[model samples]
Target: MYTRLGVVEYPEIDTHRTTRLFTTDFNNTFILFLQLICFSGSLTKSSLLEAVRMLATYRVHRLPVIDPISLDPVGVLTPKRILRFLWHHGQDIFQPSHCIKTPKQLNIGTWKGIHVVYPHTPLIDCLDILLNMGVSSVPVVEHLTLRVIDAYCRCDAMNIAMQNEDFKLKINVKQALEFKTFATDRACAVIVSEAESFYKVICKLVETNVHRAFIINCSSVIRGIVSISDVMKAVVLEPGSHLNSYCISHRRFAEFLFETPTMETQAEEVDNEDTKTSCTSRSSSRTLS
Candidate 1:
């Protein structure tokens, strides 16, 4: 059985603050986000593929895998991980029908040891982890048990970069919290359980207008992450699946403000600076391999 997650209430966008933060400087602060739905663990390959279609349509980056009984998240999936998996395991997906027989046909264990950060970490420091690490997002987990808590993604990085000039000197995740910047609400993350089929997860992703869904086990413990990239790779391997037909293609809500070339350039430069960070060289080999 699959669980259908929905947006109970709409997220109120602080357009004025977001605009000012992008336009001016530290003079402005605060970003608000709402909660989202979850998917089940029992999702099959078709359902997984569908989830990817939904993500492509919605332009979401991550998928949280959830448990059936406990409903806890087990893993977080991303496009890069999916691409890497497909690159490593080409034989299984390229069958006669160009289709996956089951969700287990693909190996999902690759993301189990991905890097993560604590919720209390400073925003600048977190940005350092993401930019230098080349990973799209980082999950906030309990240090002792590695249990999932929250996430910080490229979208979040872009938000901070917008204020780079004003906040260039010093800032932390806690400071962003003090000002209510970004959607810190766990509700914004979409959840999925192991029992749900891939098709159901995909439908939920589209129905809820979210970018990613969380996958969890019975104890609500995270097992693996899934993303649109993962699903698209499935479609690409299967042929004639036509993933783009699912949802409308548009810029993500997080990217609404940076339409101009200058802003775009600034954003790219901010992201690229991670390369020069002290940690990039040290971790690049490990992260890529």
Candidate 2:
């Protein structure tokens, strides 16, 4: 009746504590509400650590690589990218003594941009973007600077609908975000360099309890991102364990088609009803006996 992933509450920062604004829809799905921005880099251990901490606290799955000086959008960080990096390097990653090329060493080509929306974009329009792109959130960027100012996730939409209940799609994104008092400490984006090691990356993520890290080159150019799933795959492949079975625990739920009561149970209920009716009739016929 419940999913394994859903059963175990994943460890994440309490949204209530992290931000002033929170919203939900009638179905209880968390709508993308808060635009807390966190960024990390692939170069420096300190930079990566801070980035991971912010991502985990904000519950973001991925982040865009942005230049600090220029504030331009660059590449993105994700779980799959991290996995590939580990696959190429192997157990050498675990060895403390070995020094490897930091993520900055790898050239991620020209920073291809990801999908983004504007702050004033209508909720209905952004919703369409989410559905069309099949993305959980869309970065709200400054049109001219290409700076990522905020983010809108499906969770926020869900929460907004919960609060509004009217399902007004015409509202602007800023209006939807009005539930909270917006503030920022530093530039929201996390920046990292290419000189950091995989050892540091893993530690930063584990310590910060985040899922993804973005990479940047020394030039402050965006490289790419890494994710927790990527690291796990690397670990699994190292032990010669089959990746197929890693997902086997998920099959337990699929085996049962329906968990509702069986036809036999329904029949039993009918039979009990009949017995009760007969008893009532017999009592009435006997009067006060």
Candidate 3:
């Protein structure tokens, strides 16, 4: 099913514009700044497996499901919705379930080359790291201990749009985490232990409604991160049980899941080799998709 509408992104919107302009009256006219010529990746009546693969490959959070005849978006697909569906129906689908295995056994998530930020890191600098590194979130660590205290996510960046310009310039990562733009904004890092079952990980992600969770050791040092994309990949792409029949019969199910209003459907599709290299290199890292 489509999880979101269509995907359009403004990669050039810097921290300044995201903070000052998003909440201003000019927000309505902000679409003018978007590059209209960009051709984003899209799907047309594809299989669930294909959707899952595309989502992981492109490192996108959502993709539009286009009506073949009208070329208008019928729905959007997202990793979270896919996981939710799997969480409910996974037992019926998989033979000899992989869900019970640990992420280490399944070889899921990112383990190496994780980009992290210290609590004292400038908020703008942290934002820059997110944008430059093309990562959805970064663990905020204590400088001396290297222990994860919190996280700075793309969702947190949205809160910056509601803050004053001076607040944006002066705040550090710790301060950013403490400041609440809305009542629901005060979220800590979602974490899972390395020894935890994959089922428990899914439970954590679905329960928290977060995209990814940092995998920590006994000391709470981040070892890896498992994203909804990784979870989807483990189930849908796992070596052979019985998916062909299910995938064939579930087109309507997919449609119903992905179907939603077509208003806010913009996501970025990175095509450059550099981006591919980055994504491939940091395969264990969390992506918005």
RMSD of each: 17.2, 19.7, 12.3
Prediction 3 TM-score vs. true: 0.65
Clash totals for all models, in order? Answer: 57, 25, 18
Question: Model 1: which ten-residue window has the lowest total lDDT?
Answer: 27-36
Comparing candidate 1 with candidate 3, which one achieves the higher TM-score?
Answer: 3
Rank order by lDDT, top first?
Answer: 3, 1, 2
Better of 1 and 2 by TM-score: 1
Encode model 1's per-residue lDDT on 182-261: one tens digit a residue.
65553544657756655545445555544455666676655556555555655452464754333222233223433436
Query: How high is the CA lDDT of each candidate model?
Result: 0.47, 0.44, 0.64
- Candidate 3 on 18-125: residue-level lDDT in tens? 212222223223333221101112345346676776666667787666554454567777888888887787666543444577887778888877888887776767
lDDT of 3 at 269: 23
- Summed over model 3, clashes come to 18
TM, every model = 0.43, 0.42, 0.65
